[model samples]
Target: MKLGLVIDLDTCVGCHACAVACKQWNTSGTTGPLTDYDPYGENPAGVWFNRIRSYEVDDYPNNKTVNTPMSCMHCDDAACVTVCPTGASYKREEDGIVLVDQSKCMGCNLCAWACPYGARELDEDSGVMKKCTLCVDRIYDEALPVEERQPACVMTCPTSARFFGDFDDPNSEVSTLVRERSGYAMMPEVGYNPVNKYLPPRQRPKAPTIEKKEAATGQTLIGKWMKRQKDAFNDFGKGAR
Candidate 1:
């Protein structure tokens, strides 16, 4: 069975809770320190297991707000694994989580460059490239005693926006969710065959227009001046910034 993540962009709310939770768990758990440089200072950069990025799409009157939480796609044809020269990065055939054996890592950044999505990050402290392991520690921990073990992001998400499961199973919740919600993969053109999927945003009602009403009003001196100013900026580039 191929395991993966299903992210709901519509319900994400631009919250970085998942990223924070992943960092916390990975740093304190089985994984090593998620180093930070000048964290509270001017330039801050660190190795993060996950990142939440915002984007504006569908311009004009029908604009849309999107908050995309991204991590390792754990692609079926993972480029990171294929490019690793030290046998550090490997794709688990059982679960499809691309992981790095820190012990074997030689601080080479080749895998990070090969990844199209920029999932893997280089840790300055350890001198190794790191990426999300899909919470392997929690999933296999006997102490937790969970009915179904899942990633920290999936487990800690307050809105239940993140889902973790085997995508290959036709009966699985992840599969059913993908089919029902019309979920889609990001940047299908890149063709890494990402395992993670994002549900399309809910369509909004068209905005009402009052152009005709405004046009009916007799042009005042101020309106003429405004028109001349707009023309100056648009046509003549006089007041353009």
Candidate 2:
């Protein structure tokens, strides 16, 4: 099965919930304890499997914000896997989830450099590459409830903006959304053929405008009051001068 995610850009509110959930679950998971460097210090940095980036379209009143929660794309033509000198990085044929074998990883940073999506990060403490595994360990656990087997990001999205499923199945929810919503892959020009797709924000309907009536025959109370106030201010300014 081609397992992956379909993220709805329309509903995502730029909340870091998915990223936080991914970090929390993966920290103690099969591939982690994602390391932090000087976490409480001046230059705090850490390895994270998922991250959120927001972009603004247009300007001012008409501007719209797009929040993109990104992770390893699990590409069909994964450069990270190919560039690994020690074969530490590999994509599983069974599910198409890209993972790094920490045991064989030599911290060469080649995979990180090779990835166009910037999905992989080196564990500063462990000296190994780490990335999103699509929560492989969690998804395949027979002991867990089937509903809870999805990736942590998909589980914790409060807006239900994230979806996890078999992308290869044409009838799957992810595939259906892709077909109906014109979901698209990021950086297609890079040619990684990323598995995960993003559903673009739906077009907002324009608000109905009210046609302005012609000027009233006489100045209204508020308008007349404003005129009197302006004259008073002008007279006061002249007296002061």
Candidate 3:
């Protein structure tokens, strides 16, 4: 019954909708004090359960942008749990979620240092290490309808790119999707054994075009020079804009 996420990189639009939805739901409900500091001032810092980062994987002539949604990995051998001296941080065997018992925490900040993925953070108010609980409060509440019980971020994702399910079940949607689409774990070298898996970027077929030949042959010297200048200007504008 180990619960987890299955995020699809293929359909993600690089929009921050998922992150914003997490913040919005976690603030006024069962989630902790997701505070924002100096919001209007010079620097703005806040606790975020989910973060979306856009990565440019420019494979030269065939470039692509991948938008990754990152959060607590809820690992099988979670380092934060091992580092907690007071048994505050523990992984739930039933659902495979890692949580910190705020009442027992001493705000030692040791747990945060142990996490290589930057998953842990010190909660100033609770004096404890805080991270994504995968919206545990909503998931377990019997008051809500069974199907409706899911993480706020997953529920609000416009593209339906986020999936919630039991990874242990071989036939589950998440697991089936993983197998069919070639899913991969993030930072496998770290050996955290994360429950969630990222579906690999689908390989698109190269269309037969005259441009490929033009690039390979380096023909039309003047045209090539013009295209280069135009490319440079476009790149500069993209950076600036």
lDDT of 1: 0.84
Better of 1 and 2 by lDDT: 2
lDDT of 3 at 93: 79
**Per-model C-alpha lDDT, please?**
0.84, 0.90, 0.82
| Reference-based TM-score, model 2 | 0.84
Candidate 3 on 147-220: residue-level lDDT in tens?
A: 87999888999998999998899999999999999988898888889888898788998654456555534468
- Shift in Å, residue 21, candidate 3: 1.3
Candidate order (lDDT): 2, 1, 3
Clashing pairs in 3: none
lDDT: worst 10-residue window of model 2: 209-218
Error of 1 at 174 (Å): 0.8
Tens digits of per-residue lDDT, candidate 2, 5-96, equal 99999999989999999999999999988888887999889989998998776643355779999999999999988989999999998999
* Stretches > 4 Å off in candidate 1: 207-241
Query: Can you tell me which runs of candidate 3 are displaced by over 4 Å?
Result: 207-241
- Cα RMSD to the true fold for all candidates: 4.4, 9.6, 4.0
lDDT for residue 231 in candidate 3, whole number 0-100: 71
